[model samples]
Target: MRHAETVTFGGSGLDRAAALRSMPDLMDRARREGTALSILLWRGKPLVQAGSLDQLVRLPMDHPIIKSGRHVDADSEILLGREADGTLVFAHDMSSWLPAGLEATSLNTFLDASEQQHPDLPQDAVFAELRRIMTSLNARDAELAATAKALYSWHASHGFCACCGVASEIAQAGWQRGCPSCNAQHFPRTDPVVIMLILNGNSVLMGRSPGWPDGMYSLLAGFVEPGETIEAAVRREVMEETQVQVGAVRYLASQPWAFPTSLMIGCEGIATSTEITVDPVEIEDAIWVTREEMAQVFAGQHPDIAPARKGAIAHFLLRNWLADTLD
Candidate 1:
């Protein structure tokens, strides 16, 4: 846990300007006086330059897309945060725009390699999947992209009041939804998930869900249920999935996983029982991988297993484990 906060979306200290969220006058001045810029997201993919260098595409507040009131309406402009130069940054959703020759089936897949270009935008810029380019982005861009994606996704699903079942309106500059009928407010949610690194001796416990590609294995993980401590969730998840008894759970690091919205809490546990009993309902396979084999997998030389995807907390934890830096 030495470089714990170095994880992706760890944070870049964006000012956020929370005070301006409630001040409509300041927000309006930022937009009207050319002090604000916005990042565009089309179907959850952020606009980025198409090149080896990863750069998030930022557009002006008065950009045609925003002015057109198609992709982003007045109420939908989400205040992401502030830049170092005192520039206000916002997030605009372009989910309404349909690209030419857009393949419906190709999107939101395991690996969405396809990129979409807007006719109104620059030739070098395209909306690409955040997961594919997450590692390429710097800390600031990663944080912004993750935050915007999570906020927009929350708005899409929770458009109604849970208390009264009536439609709610955007409030607090996209940070909240106000229920007019019941005076209730809803905020963006981040579910806590415990990803466990269970060790019996030299080997670690890893598993693969049913849809994962062959040769890909990752640390066993499950959502932290209501009223359960992180340690208890780790033990329960490990025992439930693979029937491996875990003891002595401790926190390691965390990552903001915005594959809709999840906070992956990395933890380590000592496995008291290592006998494998695969739960078909939970995971397709489970096994204890030797440290040597894990090193091979990370090197892409393992004959049977592939390494966890880079930039993920699982890969981060396993790499640090290999390097003996998880102190």
Candidate 2:
């Protein structure tokens, strides 16, 4: 776990200027001075340049699309952080705007087709799903985009104050929502999920959910319930899903999974029993695969299994486990 922070969306030591966020005219100053760097989102997808999919395209605060009132009147505007060079970074959610007369495509297909319709924006810019190309992005861009997506998602769902059931106003530079009626403050939430590699001798326990792509299996994972520890969550999840008791859970690494914001706590657990009683409600299938079989799956040689998605924590833990580097 020495290299744990190298995981995707792990903190890269960006300067999150908390003090600047409290200033009353922060957004106003950014708009007038042109000293802001804006990350653009289209219905929760980050904007990327067309040809070079690896690079993320950031818009200047004064750019045409950003200035065109749609972004100025964004659904949720977040102050992400500042750079070492003193550039203010922000995120503008453009989920409310759509290209006129353009037929809506599935989230999977919008990435490739959206760029062709928008002639007003940069010729190379296209909105793409973050999960599809997370590993290709550099550390800074990955962190910023993940932060933006998480914040936007929180705003979309949590419009009302939980304490008083009153509508809340955005405050504290998008980190908080303030309720005037009850004087309650609400903060962003990150649910903790335990994803464990359960080991029984040389084999590992893997499971696939009902709707996952065919042949896609990953490490057993479940959310940490109220007052449950990470270790307990891992053991309970494995037992509940596959009826296999786990012991000696050890922390491995973690990643910020921003598909609506969940912190994946990776772990390795030793299984005490080998019974395979699959819970049909939770998982479609569960199996014990040896290291050799996993290697074949990773190399695209396995007949009936697809490897875990490349940028996910499951894939990272498995790769390190195979290399004997999961210390």
Candidate 3:
């Protein structure tokens, strides 16, 4: 955990400016003064300058896209944070718009069409899947993208009051939802998931879900159920997935996985029993991989398996495990 902050979306330390969120007058004034920047999202993908996907494509508050986004009156816009000089940053969801004459397709195709349609926008600007480029983004971009994705996803789904089934209004700069009918309040939620690297001797236990890309496997993971501790969740998940008894579970690092808002709590667990019993319903396959094989997988030289995707906590943990640097 020594380098935990180095993880993608770990710690960018953007000033949230919490006090300003509740102050509608100040927020409006700031927006009117053109001191705010907007991060645009198309169907959950962040807009980035296409080359390398290393930086976010930030549009000024008055930019055409931002203006059109406001005109659409789409989903809730969340205030992400402010930069060091106090310029406000906001997330604007623009999923409602589509290019004329371009048929909508999957998320990937939609992103490409969005960029292609905007000839007046920055030449390199395009909506990019965060997962595909998260590992390459700098700390600040990663944090902003993750935060925006999570907040926007929350508002998109929780539009009604759970208490009274009445439509809820956004409040507190998109950080909260208020139910007018029941006078109840709701906040953004981050689901806790325990992803662990289970070790026994020189090998680690890994599994692949049913629909994962061919030859790809990752550490065992599951949601931390209600009233369950992180350690207990780790043990339970490993046991349930692979029938591998685990002991001495401890935290390693964490990553903000904003695919529908999840917080992946990475941990290292000691395996007490190595007998393999795959849970057919939970995972397609599970196996113990030795340190040597893991190294080859990371190097892209393995004959039968590819390593976990680069941005995920699975790859992070496995990389550290190979280097013996998981503090």
Candidate 4:
């Protein structure tokens, strides 16, 4: 898609400097050079210096304020990277520290709060704030969020080792949890979800899950079950949701949806049948809308339909598809 990379959290071409991830000497040198900056996460919500660039905020490691919030112990290592200017970048996990206004709330509660308030957080103002403090964030922020949230959730739910039912300890910069009793190593997990646009000429299939706001519809999606390929998942999900037979499923794009780590595998599927049989358990409704109708929905002019939420892969893929760039 021509504007695929232009989307928020799309490829920003940041030079991650991956070779340095394992080199302690190089990492130390970069840290001492004052090029090392950290992005702070308060209860999984990235800290934004109100009115800054994109969503960028500062995390100077040596700053007096940060030193006062020394939650990381000497035994813990942080994830580090390098900026284009040879500066070091790090991700700081403040899940240990109590977040302001969130001291008594659990992580799940915090996430719920963020979701409920996100639409109200002035987007342009937040982007402006992020831009003022940092030039840009690497596309990997989405990946990192996915990794961290998945791992953290795993640790939260799997405090006991699966091998021996013993408690596990966080290790390897929060990447792994070790079971002292059984020597078991546990890692983060990601669930694969297939979101497909099933097309029959000019119209595309869309559905809405129960409980979603009225008039909201999106591409049919479902989790890829064990031993299922992406193509198989797309076909199965679409068939299961709408009883619409799909053929020739092809990959289009992907997004890391980190509401506890899901990889959204976007695809295009050719419809072999148009007859709709809604799975009342899986979806509340299903319908096909032509390109012209889709254009109206995107423009918020459809009297009975609402467009997909911005910044979501559904909207991203739909926009590209309408522009005939879903190549």
Candidate closest to the true structure, highest TM-score? 1
Question: How do the residues 24-62 of candidate 3 rate in per-residue lDDT, one tens digit apiece?
Answer: 888778888988888877667788888667789888877
> How many residue pairs in model 3 have overlapping backbones?
1
Cα lDDT computed for each candidate against the true fold: 0.90, 0.85, 0.85, 0.67
The weakest ten consecutive residues by lDDT in model 4 span 126-135
Cα RMSD for predicted model 1 = 1.2
Candidate 1 lDDT, tens digit per residue, 1-327?
778988888858888889888998897898899999989888899999987538899998898878888646446789999998989999988887877777663898877888888878888998898889989999999999999999999999999999999999999999999999999999999999999889888999999987777889999999999999999999999989989898899999999999899999999999999799988999999989999999999889999998887889999999998898999
Predictions ranked by lDDT, top down? 1, 2, 3, 4
TM-score of each: 0.97, 0.94, 0.94, 0.79
Runs in model 3 deviating more than 4 A are 68-72, 100-104, 108-120
Span of ten consecutive residues with least summed lDDT in model 1: 67-76
lDDT of 1 at 29: 91
Candidate 2, residue 326: the lDDT equals 92
Tens digits of per-residue lDDT, candidate 2, 104-198, equal 55554412334432555687787778887688888899999898899888888899999989999999889999999999999999999999999
- Candidate 1 lDDT score relative to the true structure: 0.90
